[model samples]
Every structure is written in structure tokens, then in C-alpha cells.
Target: MTDYEKFKIRHNVITLGKKEYDIAIDKFVRKALKNKDVVSIYKIGSIRYPGLSDIDLIVFLKDRPKHFSIKKFSIKNLSAKEKYMFMHEIFAVPDSMGGKIKLLYPIFSLEHLGGKKYDFIEPETSDFIPFFIQEYVKGYMSWPDRIIRKGIIDEREIIPQVYATKYSIGIYQKILGYSSKEFERKCRQYIKVAENLREDFYKTKKDERDKIIIDLIYLTKEINNAMFFDLKKYLDKNIKTKPRTITLYLGFRPNIVVFNKHIDYMEFLNIRFLPSNFSLICKKDLSGAFNDEKLEKAFEKRYKLIEQYDDFIYKNNLGRFMMLTNMKSQFNITSFIKKRVSKN
Candidate 1:
């Protein structure tokens, strides 16, 4: 490959940028490719969309390590300025990025891939991306509490399947443009139905609301069924090739921020009702029950801190103070200047 072709866009996708750290990923990926034992490397999480917090990944290796030792590779380090920013093997989901520079949590799996030490073999799987999508649905049904657990956040695991309809939207637009009469008609009908019913999902009964907890476990089975019927059909038909090891690099910066847009509820459709029959989406009951004492305490602590910060910023008229800048020094420039003048 020539130097000119190295950074060129392919298939309308851009994968290189001006930041030093963003460039470093290309270098790291290149090095990983040279390894004989590396089976595959998948780029996942916020990096796939806009407003990227960090480049998250999952590696499928010939052998899996017993424990993963990972490094924090921030494009711009915010440890001194942010709470819990430097936890070992933990990517503190930035409340807001300090700037546009991308962050790379450089291959957490690499941490445990010591010099020639190997453990379990990497599992063989056919539907890699589909597995990711289905897992989110299952977690919503089975382990909703873990989704909100404090500390290291995993966007790959938690981003609701409903948000991914945007991708389906993109694909349908392509189908429409192709002049496929039957397919386009069906696509338009499905989208219209989705738009109409997205607003009016039935409310949970009073008895269901007063349970020990109102996590999304109740909504999961619905999501999973949708995943099988609606999502599976769309994906299989569109992504109609055996997958390969891919390094997903969104060369341009995505414009969404985690702090500005934290997920309030799980998003998915009543796929049981088809495109042929438009139906409403299932949402989490917002009036939550915190039966776990530990989780309740944790929520209160985070809630109070955020509440105080919001009040501080509202009174000060300062910019939205991210968790990244919350703990940074608030030094008085006037006082320092006066002290310097006295010394002179």
C-alpha cells in the first residue's frame, strides 16, 4: 500500500484523523495483525457512533488469558481532573469529554496476553455482530440491575437495541433508492407504523410498579422476541456475508456525549407485531424500585454529587461542568497575579 492510499477513504468510510492517539490505534492494530495467534479483533461501543468517549473493543484470540490486565490509553489524560478516572482496567465513562480528541482503552485483552502465557481457547462463533445485538436484549430481560451498576460502564453491552433502528433506517433508505417495488413498499409501511406507535406503549399496572425493583427484567422477554423476529430478519438479509475480523475506526469525531445523553430507559419494539402490523415499543418503568441496599446507597452518592454540581454551574453560569472537570483546581488568577506583583 502506498503512503497516499494509507489514509484514503474507502467505501465512503473515513478512518484516520489529526490526533496523535487516534493515529496510535492504526499503529496498534497493525502490530496486532502481525501476531500469528490473534484470531480476530472487534472494535465496539461508543466509537461506533458519535460523541465517542473511548474506543472499546473485544478480541477473539487463539487462546484466552486467565485474567485480563489492561491499560488506560486516554488521548488526553483526565485522571487528575476526574474522579475514578484511573481505575485499573476500568474506563470511567466520561461524563463529558474535555475535548474532541478520541480515547483508546487499548485492547484490554492485551493486558492478560503475557509473554507466551495462554489459557482457554477463544470460542468459535458464527454470528458475531448478531450476538452483540442479542446479548443486549437478553441483559435487558435477565440482568437489568447490572446494567446500572456503578463503576466501569460498557456501552457495547448496554446501548439499547431501539437506538440501533437508526442503522435499519439507513439500510431501508438504500433499498428504497434501488427501485425494488415490493421491498420499498414493505419498508415504508414498517417505518410508518413504527413512527405512529412509538409514543403510546401501555403503562404497567400499579401492582407491577410496587415490586421490590423495577429494573428492565420484565421488558427483556419482549425485546428478545423482537430481536428474533424483526431484527434478525433485517440483519441477516442486509449483512449477507460471512463476517471477517474488523477494526471499526470512525475517523471523524462522533458528536454525541455520554453525560449530556445518559440512557434513561431500555429501547426496543413489540416486534411480535410485524411491519405488516405496526406496534408500540416497550419502555422501562421510570418509577424505579431500589431493593438492593448497596445499589440504593451508590445511586444516592452519585445523585447528590451531580445535584451539587448542577447547582454550582447554574449559579456560576459556567459551561456544563463534566465529571472530568469537576475535581480540577479552581484557582483564582487575580490572587496569583497580585502575589507575583508584590514579589517583583
Candidate 2:
């Protein structure tokens, strides 16, 4: 059998019937390719369970087009809401020639559909991006807790979202690298627990349902802990400076030492979020740093510390921090300055 045939067979086994969906998917791909700017389209995410998961397609473009739309292409399998959501997702991606290709997970299966074959340049996997993803996914983890807090009795509405979050955690765990067999095993085990819990949710009563949700939350925590253990260890060892929090934004330096919380640092630095570059956070209605001179001095000092961080990362062979800052900047650097940085 050909490689593509083998690949399709494997997907059929995973989806338990890809043949049914293939016709619609083929049509969708052909329709999507109507746009000249559409370079390639990729079907992402694991559609392991049928109804719970929706089709995720990543449409890559050569350049920013004047207009883009996916409303006309209809998938009978997908609800009107799902199609609308997919349209929004396609529109959300800022498609520039060399913009960072952010995936739902780093280790997603990118099945090519139609259009010219183009190489998708994913950013180098670093502590910076993964850490942010990890933090962001934590919001999903809190759904069960939120439901419980709000005295939500009918779990039928909330179960799907929880399942989706569990699936996402499993996928994102793949980016940590498959070096650790034990970590992978834990992920699978936790995901299986989540799956079982989801199935049982419909059959059980309110009390039993609550128990299931709690179990799901526990399993979710276990998976997250196992997944991020190595990252936590690395951060514990490396990250210097006690920033207010380990929270990361796109622009405004890799490490920002907050002198005062109130000051608009972006305005102070005169940084804007460029299409090609990471944008600075908003400048208005912030508090903290009152003295402009002190804030400027703090920023300069922070830049020097960042230089030291770069040297340490390169020495350790951990890759550069998201292609930011001048690696060759002659700002007088030092070897790994150790400070008590907050852990994520």
C-alpha cells in the first residue's frame, strides 16, 4: 500500500470510520483552495471520539490577503455553529509571510488536504512558549471547579468542554518531547480516566456525577503535573529575578522587572505590536512606576540581566528565547546571574 493509503487507514482506525468523513473533507479542501493565497490546508487534532470533537483545519497562506472567508463551504457533519466557529478560527490567524505558526499543540498531526505544498515554520520549542500554553490551559482545568462553584447540577452541558480540555492537555504534553516513557504513560492513563468519567457522567445520578467530575479534576491535575514536571524543574534551576509573577506577554523583553505596577511600560519604552514583531502591552490606565528616570534605569538594568540569561541558555544548549533581542549585543554580559525568580 502507498504511504498515503497507510496513513488514511490509520486515521480510519482512530476515527473508527474516516471513509464517511472523507468525501466532505475532500470537498472542503477543494473549496478552500479557491483562494489564490491559500498555500496549504492541514487537518489537525485527534478525532478519537466522534461527536465530542469537531474538525480543526489550519489554513496556511503565502501572505496577508485583502479578504478571507470560509462561510460558503458547507460540511453536513458539522453544525452551523461549528462551521461558524471554524470560520472565526481561520480568520483569527494573522497570516503573514513569516509570522509565528502557533498550533493548538506542538505535536499535532498535520494531514495535508489541498493547495500548493508549503513548509510550515513552527517556532523553536522553548520554555517561553510552552510555559505560556501551560498557563493558558490551566484556565480550562478550572471548568469543573467553576461548575461546582456555581452549583451547576446538569453536567450534560459542561462535560463536553471538560473532555475537550482533557484531550488538549494530552496533545500539548507531546511537545515536552517523548524522551520520558513514564510521562507518556501517565498522560495516557489520565486521559483514559477522563474518557471513562465522561462516559459514566450520563449514566450516573447527581451525587455520583459530582464524584466523577471531581475524579476528572484530579486526573487532569495529575496529567498536568506529569506533563510539566520537567519544565518546572528547568525553571526552578534557571529563572532568575523575582518578577511580580512569572506571567509572560508577547513583547516588552523576555524578562521585565516591574519597579511599579501602575506605569505603562509599553508607552515608556515606545513599543508597539507590529505585524512582523511581537507587540507591547497597552500603555494607558496602568499603575505603579511613578518616577520616569528610575523606571528607565530599571529597564536598562533589566536588559543587562536578559543578556546574562541569553549566555546561560546558549551555554546550556536550551535554544534562544523566541528569537528576541540581539544575541551579539555588546552590552557587557556575565555568566548566569542567579536570583530568586518566581516559578510558574
The lDDT of each candidate is 0.29, 0.41
Model 1 reaches what TM-score against the true structure?
0.23
| Candidate 2 residue lDDT tens string, 11-107 | 1111124444555456667766886656667676655544334456666554444334333333334555444233223322223422233322243
- The worst-scoring run of ten residues by lDDT in candidate 1 lies at 251-260
Q: Which candidate is the best by lDDT?
A: 2
Model 1 lDDT tens row, 89-110 = 2222211211111211111133
Clashing residue pairs, backbone N/CA/C < 3 A, model 1: 50-254, 51-254, 51-255, 51-256, 69-111, 141-220
Clash number by candidate, in order? 6, 6
| Model 2 stretches with alpha carbons more than 4 Å out | 1-20, 70-107, 121-139, 151-188, 195-214, 221-236, 242-344
Q: How accurate is candidate 2 locally (lDDT)?
A: 0.41
**Per-prediction TM-score to the true structure, in the order listed:** 0.23, 0.48
